[model samples]
Target: MPIRAVVFDFGGVLFDWNPDHLYRQLIPDAEERRRFLSEVCSPAWNLQQDAGRPIAEANAVLVAEHPQHAALIRAFYERWPETLAGLLPEGVALMERLEAAGMPLYGLTNWSAETFPYAWEHYPLLHRFRHIVVSGREKLIKPDPAIYRLLFQRMAQDLPALQPAELVFIDDSQKNADAASALGWHGIHHLDAQTTAARLHALGVDC
Candidate 1:
């Protein structure tokens, strides 16, 4: 069956989200900034927050471990909005095109429940989605088949239920895309708006 909807990942795919954007000001040295992010405020550490851990608790645990970097750890969430530069214009244009073409759009994101509100306030485009499944709210992150299944289950509650095979899941992470594809959903490993638009066009998305 043809795809009925397009699912998007928020952070990298739709917006520019990089800790370095915020850390560059705090840590002067380029190499040191990279080291601080990789060793101290690691992706693994942040993933805990994405999985539903309170940002305050996560910050406290890290601060206690590295008292020297206490301020930096707190700044991660305290100045979190700085990390998001803005929504990618190209991505927004593609979404607009898709919307104009009357394609259904949904979102699935591994974001902190605590900070997602900030994004909701800043980015009005999020409200355009038919629905969004947030990992922090659900306590389930992508690359986990259960989370993918949960999205389908939620959609099933609607009239004329959406099928997995009738959706194309797009993400910056190859693993997440592969996971969706494994579940019979079309997967788009999104790199940029241009490529993503082309891929959608090829998929008969008309956007």
Candidate 2:
């Protein structure tokens, strides 16, 4: 079957999402940074938090376990935004090409309700997509079969209409991409948008 839809992960793929930058701006002390990384900076913890766990509850447990970075963690959690700071030019061009080609497009992002709207506002290009699925609003996170299943269900396409192995999905996390591939969706390990777009083009995506 020919490719029908193109999906993208927001963070690291569409734009730069570096937690270290946050720490560099907010917490300048090397000792404090080390302590925080050890106590509170496991990237995988985001997966746990996104998997329907209450953010407040997660914070409480972390603070109880490690009081030193509790204040920083709380502030970081509160300050987090849904949309990125700026759009990547390459990403914009690629999406434009995809849209111009009449290829169906969708976005599957592990995003927060608070910040998702910001991206929608600052990046009007989102209006070009067929659908946008945000984990925070859906109350379902990724790398889970259920979330992926929800995407398939909401799409409401006949199985015969899509090549499960050919439908392209781009995500920065290898674990998430691998999991998506395991469930029969083709996953592209993404870096920057231009490289990703080129790779997808090679995979037969229009742009």
**Candidate 2: where is the Cα deviation over 4 Å?**
30-35, 157-160
Each candidate: RMSD: 1.1, 2.9
The window of 10 residues in a row where model 1 has the poorest summed lDDT is: 154-163
Task: Report clash pairs, candidate 1.
Answer: none
C-alpha lDDT of all candidate models, in order: 0.89, 0.72
lDDT (Cα, tens digit) per residue for candidate 2, span 1-207: 467778877777666555565676677997877666555855656555645456787778878877877777776567655213566677667777888988778888887665567678867777877777788777888777677777776665533455566567888888778777888888888777777878777778777
Q: Roughly what TM-score does model 2 have, to 2 decimal places? A: 0.82
lDDT over C-alpha atoms for residue 141 of model 1: 93
What is the C-alpha lDDT profile of model 1 across 1-207, one tens digit per residue?
Answer: 787888889878889999999999999899999988998999999999999998889988999999999999899999999999998888888888888998888898999999899999988999998888999999999889988888787766652767778889989999999999999999889899899988888888898
**What is candidate 2's CA lDDT for residue 91?**
69
lDDT of 1: 0.89
**How many clashing pairs per prediction, in order?**
0, 1
